[model samples]
Every structure is written in structure tokens, then in C-alpha cells.
Target: MAKLYSKQKLAGQSMLPKKETIAFILNYSKALSIKKIGKMSFEIIAN
Candidate 1:
């Protein structure tokens, strides 16, 4: 996803392993689904 790519860029770190990115996206989506956290964008999360 774009968010994942952006995160990798923002970190200035080497590319994250595919599995780790996938897991993070899954968990993040689950968290979003469970609660209506407002305006929690990728930029916020990355920081």
C-alpha cells in the first residue's frame, strides 16, 4: 500500500520485509475497525 511505502521513505530506513509490512497493515486495519479513532493517518502513525 502507499501508506507502507511512505512509511519506509519517512523512516529513511531500508525497505521493510514484506511480511512485516503486511502484518503491520493487517493489525492497523484491525485496530481501525475495532475503534473509531479519528484522523489517525499514516503520517501520524509513522512518527
Candidate 2:
């Protein structure tokens, strides 16, 4: 997950807000992926 965030940052993609907890980011990412929400990537959702 850290690697993912780092890559996203490097790519200038949206990231999980710094004010948000890591736990929140992980769970939210999981939930979205599991539900296949919007067929979007985490980067898009983070934005």
C-alpha cells in the first residue's frame, strides 16, 4: 500500500488526504475494489 501511494504520488495522481488515517485509506480502498465501485482506480477515488 505504501508503494502504491508512493507510485501515485510520483505519477501526480490524487492521494488519500494526509489528514485521513491510514486505516481509513486501506479500508476504503478495499471496499471500493470489492464492490467494483464506478470501475475506478484508487487514484481517481482519492481525487
Candidate 3:
């Protein structure tokens, strides 16, 4: 998923909800800025 984060720096962006599972990301990837809220838990920090 590090690739996703780095890609965000390239200029283009993606729209996203406030929360999503990593598994969903694995299937359909988006470089929305997210932060881990707990072990195996993450939240969309920005759109």
C-alpha cells in the first residue's frame, strides 16, 4: 500500500469515503490519505 501513498505525491488524486477496509484497497486501489486508528484498523484522514 506504500505505492498508493507515494502515488498521491505524483499530482493526481482520488475521491474516497471517510473509512474503508484494507482488503477493499487491495482489490480496488486508491491513494487517499489514511491513518491507522488501531491494529489492522485505518481511517481516511483526507479525501
Candidate 1 lowest-lDDT run of ten: 38-47
Tens-digit per-residue lDDT, 8-34, candidate 2: 556676765665587777878765532
lDDT of 3 by residue, 1-47 (tens): 24567645556546655455656675455546556666665755343
| Residue 13 displacement (Å), model 3 | 28
Candidate 2 vs candidate 3, TM-score winner: 2
TM-score of each prediction: 0.33, 0.28, 0.19
lDDT of 1 by residue, 1-47 (tens): 34556555565767667898999888776565332458553433322
Off by more than 4 A, model 1: 1-17, 34-47
lDDT (Cα, 0-100) at 43 in candidate 2: 42
Best prediction by lDDT: 1
Residue 11, model 1, lDDT:
58
TM-score of 2: 0.28
Which runs of model 3 end up more than 4 angstroms from their true locations? 1-31, 43-47
Lowest lDDT sum, 10 consecutive residues, model 3, at 26-35
